[model samples]
Target: MSGDDAKRASDAASARDKLLWIIIYSLCSSTMLVINKLAVGANGLPTVVAGAQLAVSAAVVVVMEFAGAGVLGPFEKKRIVPFVLYTTMFAMGLFSNMKALMLTNVGAVISARCCLPLIVCSIEWFFMNRAFPNARSVMSLMGVVVSAGIYIANDTGVDIQGGAGMFWLLVWWLLLAVQMTYGKHLTENIAMTQWERVFYTNAMAIPPTIVLYYATGENELEMEDGEGAMFYLILSCVVGVAISYSGWKCRSVITATTFTLVGVLNKMATITFTIIVWPKDFSVVKTLALIASVGFGLLYTEAPLRKPKVAGAGTSPLGIKH
Candidate 1:
């Protein structure tokens, strides 16, 4: 082949690989909640379910490391502090997410999650010294908040039955926001490989999850046979591991814009599928609200952080207004 022909062929190959990873990422991301819902809904043991997923994921990482995947890097003592903090937040987020899934429908969870970017960006701005989002982004954030409120108002699921359900959902939302923000901090400030971060987060989360499982008396909760639920729970763990890899793989091959778009599309697909499959407490208003929330979330792009050169200052500051 000529030089141009060779370059074209490589480009085609790259595009194909990117498409494959995008599909994988979408499937894993979309289906995980439904699977977790099935598991927790059947067993009524969100703590155990969450802990099991974490344990399985950690084991997978260990196996991958031993199998010469080269995913494991040398352990650093300095990373332990941040990793532990991240793990505690991660564990709490996982449990609360499972609990929320148990109480609410998939649509409710997705709609609530639409507000996460607002919290995350606020943390970036106030605590991380990042710049505020631009005009369009700010508008989108407002839309997300409003649409999320609409969904919440219209939602008639178990979550809205009383204060406890909303409480768990709020806990999930806040902990997830903290996890995302601090996770970004870990990436920017701490020096660790991606898989190493993954391994540490998953592994360190296991102990706390175990503590929560027994501490909450989930161990004594008598579970029914729930063969189908057991299957779904196992599938949830498998997909949990798959999502970690597929998400990273997709990000490696795609632009930030493409990644964000895929995330939006995946959530839309998940909402649609969940409605079709479960159809519990489904309403036209709720569906439209979810669509609006996710659509607005799509509009919000994170403000880029840039460090300007300072004359004679020895250290560059973190972020500046555009």
Candidate 2:
């Protein structure tokens, strides 16, 4: 076969691999939501439950590292600042997300999170000194807004005045945007293997998570006594972090667009699981609106709306040049 054919085949394989990882990540994320919901139902506090899961996940990653899994180069003395910044940002994002889960419906939380890619783009442009394709970026931003509008219109049970719920949800979105932007920044300087990155990031995230857990007066041991709580906690830690991180690492190798799109699509899993586990009555209009909102979000995040660029054109400092 010609070199061009070989390259095409290679690209196709990579795409398939990325897609698989996306699916895995989405499933894990969805499962985490389900487990979180279960924990709440069992009277477990969101902060405590999530913190426990994160602690376990971090421990697992650390154990894997010590078991000849991967060496940590990114944690070298010089890179500590960037490492801490990204990890703390991630911890804040996770904490906010758990708080939102406690306050709002899963679907609402997921829908609002669709704005993260746009936020990341904006942050890159303003703070990181990166330039995006203007037309494509505008289109994508519009799609996100339209999608969010559809979801909001369709949502019948959402209470805007639900005592800090909406506030927490919005906070979750903002923090996730920060996490993504900072994560991209850290990726630039990190020389560790994917596992090592996951291990260290989660390791660093543990301290803040634990502090939040205790400050909120939530107890991990007490939560485990509740029905199905142990199972939920285990799933949250093992599947949610470990599996999702592995999948994310694989997907990042393909394309930034693919990674962002896949991340957005994971919200659909939340909707799906919510419907299955918490099936609330709704009108046809509402149902259609929800479907459209999610569809638009997927398209907005993943669609190759950006024109293919010439090789070696100016790259985004955030690492999303393509």
Candidate 3:
């Protein structure tokens, strides 16, 4: 084949692979929250549920390695330290999401998450040296925030009487923003395969999750629904592994802003399914707000990285040209 033809073919293959990763991550992540809510609600122990899923994922990694799949890389302080930091925040975010789900309906929780892309994008721009979003993208992001706010204002899905539920949701949102941005950073800058990244994140999260479980007095597992809870827990673990793998794979190919944007957009399916299955406090206004949020999210594009100025040709301390 000619050189130009070969390059074109390779680019096409890369784009196809990227789309596949996006699809896989979206499906697994979208369903994971609902499954986790079911499992946690049944047992009334979010930490226990999260810990179990992480344990299952960690074991899968070990099994893969033993089977000669070679999912893990050699131990190194630099790589391991970043994974540890990310894992700590990951565990906290997972637990807080479960807590939020317990106190509110799926629609409300996911709707609140619509605002995350703005935060993620801003963090990437300031701290990670990513470019600023264009005017159109910024407008779309603002629309997302405004729509999410409208939904939250009209929402009545919180079972909790006061602001405690909102507090948990807010905490989850912030932690998720950090996790998304840092995860993208790891994917871009860290020298590791997708499996290694997945293994490290899932395995390292187990310790902190166990600590949280016991500290929260959730050591005992309650079986309120017998087979139902067990069923959801098992389902959650299965999807957890898939998402763990696909998330890293997806992040490796996409920008932080696009990754977060895909997350918000894919939840349209989740929101529809959620409303159908658990239609608590569903209203026309809320529906319109969701449509607006996802619609505007669709309009967002990943901002290109800023071009370095070439006055002196030496990089600044922040890895950008002065």
CA lDDT of every candidate: 0.69, 0.60, 0.78
TM-scores, one per candidate: 0.71, 0.75, 0.80
The residue pairs found clashing in candidate 2 are: none
Runs of candidate 2 with Cα error greater than 4 angstroms are 71-75, 94-112, 124-141, 156-173, 219-224, 254-261, 276-278, 300-322
Local accuracy of candidate 1 as per-residue lDDT tens digits, 129-180? 6667767777777776677677667764324436766888899988877766
* Candidate 3 local Cα displacement, residue 175, angstroms: 3.7
Ranking by lDDT: 3, 1, 2
User: Which residue segments of model 3 deviate by more than 4 Å?
Assistant: 1-11, 92-112, 157-174, 277-280, 308-322
Ranking by TM-score: 3, 2, 1
- Indicate whether candidate 1 or candidate 3 has the larger lDDT: 3
Q: Please report how far candidate 2 places residue 139 from its true position, in Å.
A: 4.6
lDDT of residue 130 for candidate 1: 68
Q: Candidate 2: worst 10 consecutive residues by lDDT?
A: 313-322
* Candidate 2: residue 126 Cα off by (Å): 5.4
Error of 2 at 156 (Å): 5.1
The alpha-carbon RMSD values of the candidates against the true structure, listed in the order shown, are: 7.5, 5.2, 6.3
Backbone clash total, candidate 1? 0
